[model samples]
Target: MVMVKFLGSLISVDEAVNKATRAFKDLVELRIIEKTVWDALYYVSAEDILALIDQPRYDRSAVDGYAVISSDTTGASPTNPAILRVKGYMSPSSTPEEYVVRNGEAVELATGAPLPLGADAVVMYEDTNRVGDEVEIYKPVPSGANVSRKGEDYRKGEVLVKKNTLLKPWHLSIIASTGINSVKVYEKLRIGVIGTGSELVEPGYKLSSGQIYNSTSVLVKNYVETLGLAKGKYYGVFPDEKEVLREALFKALRENHLVITTGGTGVSDEDVIRDIVDEYGEWVFRGVAMRPGRPTSAAIINDKPVFLLSGYPVAAWTGLEAIVSPTIYSILGLEKPVKPVVQGILARRVPNTVGYRSYIRVTTRIGPGNKVIVEPYMLKGSGILSSLVKTNGYIILYENIEGYEKGSIVDVILY
Candidate 1:
């Protein structure tokens, strides 16, 4: 395979994502399967929304306050209190056979209890005075007070959750209220991760003169799982041998929907990953114009997408965020993966390079004027893990502009 080098261009992040997804759109398929709600939180597939219907068909109480006929306390005032006898009490879980709420009678009820047949409103327990089962109300309440009318929270057959929503605690509650125990969701994306470098050693091992710690494998694996995208298996670090690299690349591509590797993507003597992908797969864009991640590589191997991330910690992370994330989401058939976009003020003047777009690490906070103040972390080297640990987000210096002035309106992607 002849190696071809291409200088990266300054492309809009959104446009790049669109172009990349369109290039390989038909290769991945979405499979929706029915699964119990209890087993759905393990991965992205189970978190997808199928349907969001309404609550049960009944008028229920929203609070444990009280149940009353609104008309009974129409003219009741603090000076002249209205007293009534306690007719009965009702709990949420139990069904009450007797629903007779006569005038001058107040019924006790718990939170989520269905409104009695005759009660048109409810007075809170705190607002009423009960002297040995005799109830006294100082204020008058209107009809439907303290009551959740039937179909009020949600109407029957009303769709609450749209398709592709990531199920949260509230979503699960919605499903349970809608009487749905199971839902249809998309299948999770399977990811394989390979760390390339002969000198790299895994953590918990003694450091030698010729060895470095293998940080990329664990980092990439955790990164994939944190997004609820996929379960990643780390194949550990391999040497620069072409045959070993080829076997690892081929195996990962054949089994996983996506394979992401760190190290060996740089333009160095030991960088064999890009060459391996070039030999085995259809190479896509091989480089990006963004600093730190300029050496990034991408290709399709055995019909599966493969990404060769930079050996630098921050670069690998940035490239994964900018490229691999969207690809995974698209393969899973998710419409839009919501990312946190924050607007901030540049604390100081930012100098930029002429042709290369820069991603500067920044620390963001709300200042005295309630403005988001972003302070640059000032670390630009690709291998600086300490900078990433201290920074909160990234600030972009566009290719068109030379630099940014203090107090400029800048948009940032919050980490």
Candidate 2:
């Protein structure tokens, strides 16, 4: 193993994601999956679905009526009804009876029954009188009136589903209706989360004077699951020891497609993650040009990705949203996930440092004239976990932009 110093040049969010995507471009595999197991899997279709057998497959009645040709009911009136002989009955069933209506005849049928071969329209029974095997029509009908034509819903050779579609329940229904029982989809990427710090204790354990409960593992796990990008497993916390951390990293790399660690990548002497990465892996990038999550780093070991995030809750979250999530989706060839946002007026002015992309947490309320007013949370420390709970979302200040004025409108990305 060779040691390499951390690269201090900070890249933009998009550049970081592109680099990560290039690294894992060929990492995921495609598998043939049955419809039964595709309920909630994140996947992209492997090929184009060019056709579907005609929907409904036949012309059927849209209402309960007598099937007749349009011309047969010509000049029909209440004073002098057009009389016709009743042919037969047609019902909607697995084995429907066949009945043909000639020029001077009509067939009685229920709603959704296939139209007889010679009928071009349907007249409701309300407009007719039944006397023995004859019926008197009182009104006229046009061709295709009250008829569900063949291929009305969908046609054969029509595109059923496109390639790279994220399958939903309705999408599955459509595919099933076309008689497709299995499909090829990109497999989900597996993620392993680990929290690191000597002073950190697992939740439910009594903390000593200098100890804090572990939250990053659970937070990262929940984030991964909620995004539907990958399945995540928590590996608890690792201390500031090189050998233990190295062993844990190796184990995680072997077990998962990607590994994420919270903490121990900063410049302080106690931060050992950077050192371990240099000694045991290859660095893709060591830092990003973003506030709060400046210590974020990425590496590859044994052909698996590893993301080192800040121990601070807010910074860890930012890293996941800004970098990790996009990379995962890119590798899977899925569209980038977008957070819901609303435009609002800033309640106060905010300052920012040049060349750093800043994320400011804010709470929103309805203002005068029904306008949304955003109030920035004053506490800006990345470690303040409660700030995240107090705010609904954050507004991003671009790297080149300084900040926004008190009344300026901005987009707030929701959590």
Candidate 3:
């Protein structure tokens, strides 16, 4: 068995992420996913798309009026309106007639109707009176007024959406308008999750004297799916035995691109994850200098990533947010996900250890002068899962910073 070298000092969060990114930079697999333009909502584009056809397709009217030459209605008013011969009516769907508006002629058309040949402007009916076959145009219009020129919205061969763009609703509409029926998107990542511990039991099962319900597996699966990062497959709970853990880890590694296991990462006798990593995998990092998740570890088995997170609910969650999530984003060619945050004043003094990064959970309320007041959750233990439910988000204390004083303005990342 290979002896594992545990780094004496913990690495910073940025260093850890950078290392993981380099390890998996060439591992992201790209697949062409064909989706109909109508149902392609929220799918990231795999390639840049060019317009196949122009919008409007032709010069059209923008209102229900008469199409005419601008020079014909020049200097016309109510008192001395320009009189022009009225031609046949034109609907939006009708083909443009083989006719032209002479110096003193008009063709009545509805909104969106194609402009007849030689017509450069439109005169609203409200500004003119009709008598027999002639109408009076009271207002003067310039060339191209009230006209939507062909290719005005988008020209053919113009780039509509760039590669790796997350398609929104409006993007789908635009693609459809360009006559594109389908688009290509990247495939979702496949992630395998395993929760290990002899004392762990699945939810709805009766727990024995030393057993607790297995919550981390479900949490990991749901969190991965909800973020649209990957499809999570839970392999159920495994005992702390080395052989059993090894078999499960090997199977998960073979089946998924990435694997995550919660529990058995600490330095206790039952913590068999470290030994398994030493025996069958290459250890990347054994720990990070972050509170609530100091024992988080990562390894490479058969050239695939395997993250070992703490069993405690809060610690497991922190590891996922700080480590696993960033790695996945890097693989997907996306920018790091940003958490919504609010600026607030710390309501009380909080102490922390220097050289260790801290995540302090806090609840917020509107205080005097409409200022947001953040109240830190007193219970800071990693095993206290209830604190997560009670607090909206957490405030980060950097590794070099000791703590925050009362009334200090800070940014709180919301859940």
Candidate 4:
């Protein structure tokens, strides 16, 4: 007979986090790996990335115009324009030595061209009427106008990218600006991802009447990889049979720093991972008091973390997002990345269970006066993956909160 119980006591999300990460303040010592800047995308930097050279290296024109002495165009305007003789033509390829703007003279230079000596400003072509060698400057420009100064972006040895950063495209460009080709980044945390349940089958194969696709494995694997903290090694679906999952659990724990198992949780006969955790591992938490993924859990086995998540897609997502991600960040001594939040007026009343922290998916639309309107999808189901798919972001109803009424402003964290 199946018995329903929390072998390890249920706890709040915050308490679970405390329990899991309390002993791991100085736990980080991951190996650093060198990667080409091109391949460093998404990897966390292990060292401070410094700029070797100044951006631009020299002052350059910011627009295609006539480089001029700022004093020559003083008080110049459309009615009483300053007429200067064009001294020479200069492109970005031209060296500053190739041209010089003396008194009453201007050099026709393209955008990004090196600013010629004796020229303190650039008057855009649109503001100048050029006829033959003479150009009428209708706009007076101050010194340094329309010019990018040397060392304006970065000076040598300045921090371009800080250590432990998730490197993005702009970070790579900044590094590339200083002619850097390689970066030192932390090696990926290897995680073993396992899916459990006799009814689960991999996609591309026939699903019998009692079977569903093992999408949790795919979701967990991809999500873990996408976070850039870890690379997932998938161990395929296993049945509810205790000995089989027991062997897979031990083997995976031996090979990875973290092991995540989906499906074998909750108070059911088929939820065997919880039993394995109780018998052979120490539970950080067996349950969390949250909606969708109440059975989300964590344990330490063989000196590594093992997270137990739900089988239902959306619930599994909540388990990973709400509990797993924060736990990982805590253990690694990394700050959790903040999600973009947008505030909107509620379109309808959305109530939450008093003690449960609820995650409500929402679709936002621009209303009158450019105001954002949030409509909560009230179809409450832990298994409702489609609800998440149809929404752009979600709102959290904290444990202390009850709900939001119509027209109440709410903050939505973008997915």
Index of the highest-TM-score prediction: 4
Candidate 4 matches the true fold with a TM-score of 0.93
* lDDT at 39, model 1: 63
Q: Which stretches of candidate 1 lie over 4 Å from their true place?
A: 1-12, 42-56, 340-343, 365-372
**lDDT leader:** 4
Alpha carbon deviation, residue 295, candidate 3 (Å)? 2.0
Model 3 vs. true fold: TM: 0.80
Show the lowest summed lDDT stretch of 10 residues, model 3. 1-10
What C-alpha lDDT do the candidate models reach, one value each?
0.75, 0.82, 0.85, 0.87
User: For model 2, what is the alpha-carbon lDDT of residue 143?
Assistant: 95
* Model 2, position 46: C-alpha lDDT score: 62
Clashing pairs in 3: none
- For residues 238-326, could you state the per-residue lDDT of candidate 1 as single tens digits? 89888998898778777777788888876566787767776777767777777767767677778877777887788888787777787
lDDT of 2 at 296: 79
The TM-score ranking, best first, is 4, 1, 2, 3
Residue 277, model 3: Cα distance from true site in angstroms? 1.1
lDDT tens readout by residue for model 3, 311-408? 88888888888887887787678876688999999999988789888888899999999999999999878788888999999998988899999999
How many clashing pairs per prediction, in order? 0, 0, 0, 0
lDDT for each residue of candidate 2 in 1-415, tens digit (9 for 90 to 100): 3343446788888788888889767765546444442463455566666546887778889999889988999999999898888888888762223776789999888998888888999999888889999989999999999999888878888877787777767767777777777776655667899888998999898989999888877788899988664679888798988888888888888888889999887766667888887777788888888877887788887778898898988889889888888888788777875679999999999888788888888999999999999999998887888779999999999888888989999999988
CA lDDT, candidate 4, residue 257: 78
TM-score of each prediction: 0.90, 0.81, 0.80, 0.93
